[model samples]
Target: MIKSMTGYGVANVENDRYIISAEIKTLNSKFLDFNLRSPRQFSDREIEIRGLVSGVLERGKVNLNIEFTAKSSTNLPVSINQELFETYFDTYKSMASRVGVNDSSDLFRLAIQAPNVVTTVSDKSDDQDEWEAVKKVVMEATQKCDEFRKDEGDTLYHKFKENLDVISKGLDEIQKEEPKRKERIKNRITNNFKDWMEENSFDENRFEQELIYYFEKLDITEEIVRLSTHLKYFDKTMSSSQSQGKKLGFISQEIGREINTIGSKANDAAIQRHVIIMKDELEKIKEQALNII
Candidate 1:
């Protein structure tokens, strides 16, 4: 199935002791680019979290943010920076004295509010239960992300089918014009040589051999056949239950090669117009395939 690399998913999980919120956002990338943000206490589990995300998301530029909040005061430990508080208090006291303020109560309040004056001490203890809870939240969020990718993939699938059909239709139009184009080429060549043959003696057998070789040089039959095969292969790959973004890209390149070959070799204005349309539709497919997985 086709899956888009760009998507967003979030999950919030809570219990009596903690509330955890996980948000994941992704964008198309050639390879996996994972970034994570979480509490300092969860630093030790970074590798595990990365592996979990990699397993689910596969390939993309992924940004994951985890917000962990303590629900119970007992679970959180608070600490006071006495030295920093003292420095702040003295500075505020000096400023107040210069302003002729007598109250020391305001100075204490200001000092307590200063940055790092009061902080929560991260619980570095290896708590298996908390890790399990966090893991659950992350997994749920990742699942939601995959679901989002699937939804986007469905939309892309329809879009790709539409463009492919248009290109196929254009190919059909070119096929319809092929007989007329060949007749025109033959007549034009015959007319141009009629005057020359009358003016100078030429070998009829040699002329026929050169004309056959020339026609072969201009033939696009092989290109058309190969392009049709590539199109079918692309459709089959899209239906497969695996990551095929890179494979789709490779197939598109092959399709382009055939399209270009036909455009250059066909040597007919009418067929060239159809080739242009097919090239345009193929470009659309290539652009969209970049975001597929």
Candidate 2:
């Protein structure tokens, strides 16, 4: 079945000390393009994460983000800069004495709230347990992404089928008009022959042979058969268990070629009109196929 290249998915996995969340978004592209964002602690896993996404997505522009939040107090290390705090306090005390101010009450509080005075330092240690948990979440998110693509693919499948049917119906109309088309062409050609016959005497056998050749040039039978075959093949490819975007594109091109040939060869106005409608439907199919993966 066909799969669309655009989708989104998210998953969260948590353990005692950490909660890892993964979010993935995809857009249609001719190749696999991965953009990843994660906490500095998990930077080492970027390569592995990309491999996982590329393996499943196959093709598209992928945005994968991972967020890790330490839920347990034991996992968080917050510290205050004691030396900086002391420096600020001494300066404040000196200024208060010089100004003959008796009050220095809020100096400690003000110093403690200074910029960069307090900060949390992450443990750079790569815990195997945490990495494993994050990996599982990544995989789960990717699975959900694939499911989204499959669901969108189902919608595209029906859309393509509907458009193909429209083209098929147009072909049916052309078939219905073919006999009348042939008679019109014959009458027109016969009138032309009658005018030529008045001008000069020509061999009847040669005239018959030349007329046959002209009729062959205008015959759309081969085009009709080839177009039908292409339509059938297009439908068959949708059921294949692999990516059929490129294949479907090629089939649509073939269908267009036959349609154009019929339009050029058709001498009947009704048949030409049917060919125009076929072209319109084929264009819609091509537009939808670009999003297939």
Candidate 3:
């Protein structure tokens, strides 16, 4: 299935003690790139996060963030910065002794104000349980992210098919004019040399040779055949059950190659108009391809 490079997905996992929320957003990019943001405790799990995303998405500017919220204060991990506590305690003691005052080391207020004194580090990377909770949330979020892409991809597929039909209809119109176009070219050539025709004394043999030479040089049958073949391959690629954004891109380039050649060689105003139309439709498809995965 085709996937769009732009999408949004979010999932939240809740347990008795914690709630884990993860979100993944992306935009179009030429290569696979992933940025992950998670709780500091799970900072060591960045590699695992990357691997999780790589397994599903192949290309995009992907950003993943997971937030962990402790559901209950009791479940919140707490740690003490003993060094900071001791500093505050001794200072209070020194001032109290110098003033001949008593000190009871009531340093709860000092400890509470100290940085890192109360931290979640104990829960972030402690071991088995923390990672297990994190992994559950991440995988759930990844699944949601994949689902989002698929849903958006379906919309892209519809647009692509619509454009393909437009291109095909234009090709049909161009084909109808092909015969009339050749006749018009012949008339123009004959009119230019009318004064030198048999009635006025022209050489029939040379005229025939010139006509054949130009016909051989200006024929667009091969180009049309190749373009049609490429179009068929393009349609087939679109219908395939795999990621073919890059492949479709290459096929469209080949379509352009043939269309351009036909335009250059045909030279008639009518055929040129069709060529321009083909080009416009192809350009639309090209732009649409950038969004597909």
Candidate 4:
């Protein structure tokens, strides 16, 4: 089944020690473009995360964000290192005495901001279990995004089917009017030949041969055949079990070429009108196909 290139998904996973959340947003793009935001600790797995998104999404402009927070207090709060604070405070006091400044309100604030004076205790040990949980959450979010795409794809599929039907109807109208159009051309040509004969002597046999050749050139039988075949092929492509956005686009181009050729050779107002309707439907199909993947 086809999938749309636009979607949004989010998932959250939690454990006794941590809560992890992942969000992904996707937009249509010619190629896979991945942007990721996550805690620095997960930087080591950035490549793997990118690979996961690429493998699933295949192509799109994707923005992924992951956030983690402690589920329970485990001494991760920012606190002053007492020893470091005392050393900075002692230096500040000595400097204050030397500079003859008794006010120390700013000294305590400045000491607190000193390097290494404030810290967050970390369990620095690598946690494979935690990484696994985070990975599961990421995959969950990706799956949700895939589901969203599938839903959007259904809408696109219906739209494409409707337009295809309209184009097919237009082609049918053109086909139905073909005989009358050809008869008009022949009548016009015969009238022209009569005028020419009255004006100047010409070989009737030669004129007949040229007329036959001219009619053959103007005949849209082959174009109609090809156009019908293209339309059928396009319908078949849509029924396939996989995404074929680009392939369908190529087929649409071929359909357009045939329609344009017919319009050029039509020389009949009615047929030209049918061709215009076909062009309109084909344009809609082309525009919607861009969102498929």
TM-score of each: 0.85, 0.83, 0.83, 0.90
Evaluate model 2: give its TM-score. 0.83
Local distance difference test scores for all models: 0.91, 0.88, 0.81, 0.88
**Error at 74, model 1, angstroms:** 4.5
Q: Which is the leading candidate under TM-score?
A: 4
Model 1 TM-score relative to the real fold: 0.85
Where does candidate 4 stray beyond 4 Å? 77-81, 119-125
Instruction: Give the alpha carbon lDDT tens digit for every residue of 116-232 in model 4.
Output: 999875534278888888889999999999889999988888888899898889888988999998889888877877877899988889989998898898899999999999999
Overlapping backbone residue pairs in candidate 3 total 0
Residue by residue across 1-293, what tens digits does model 2's lDDT show? 99999899999976678788999999988878899999987777778888888888888889999999987664337787889888988888888889887676777778888888889787564678888888889999999999999999999999988998999999999888888888888898888779789889999999899989988998999999999999999999998998679889899999999999999998678988888888999999999888998
Q: How close is candidate 3 to the true structure, as a TM-score?
A: 0.83
Looking at model 1, report the run of 10 residues with the lowest lDDT sum.
69-78
Model 3, span 139-184: residue lDDT tens: 7777777788888888888877787777677677778888988899
In Å, residue 219's CA in model 1 sits off its true spot by 0.6
**TM-score: the better of candidates 1 and 2:** 1
- Rank order (by lDDT, best first): 1, 2, 4, 3
User: Over the stretch 171-270, how does candidate 1's per-residue lDDT look in tens digits?
Assistant: 8888788889889999999999899999999999999999999999988888888998999999999989985999999999999999999999997899
Residue 124, model 2, lDDT: 62
Worst 10 residues of 3 by lDDT: 103-112
Better of 3 and 4 by TM-score: 4
TM-score between model 4 and native: 0.90
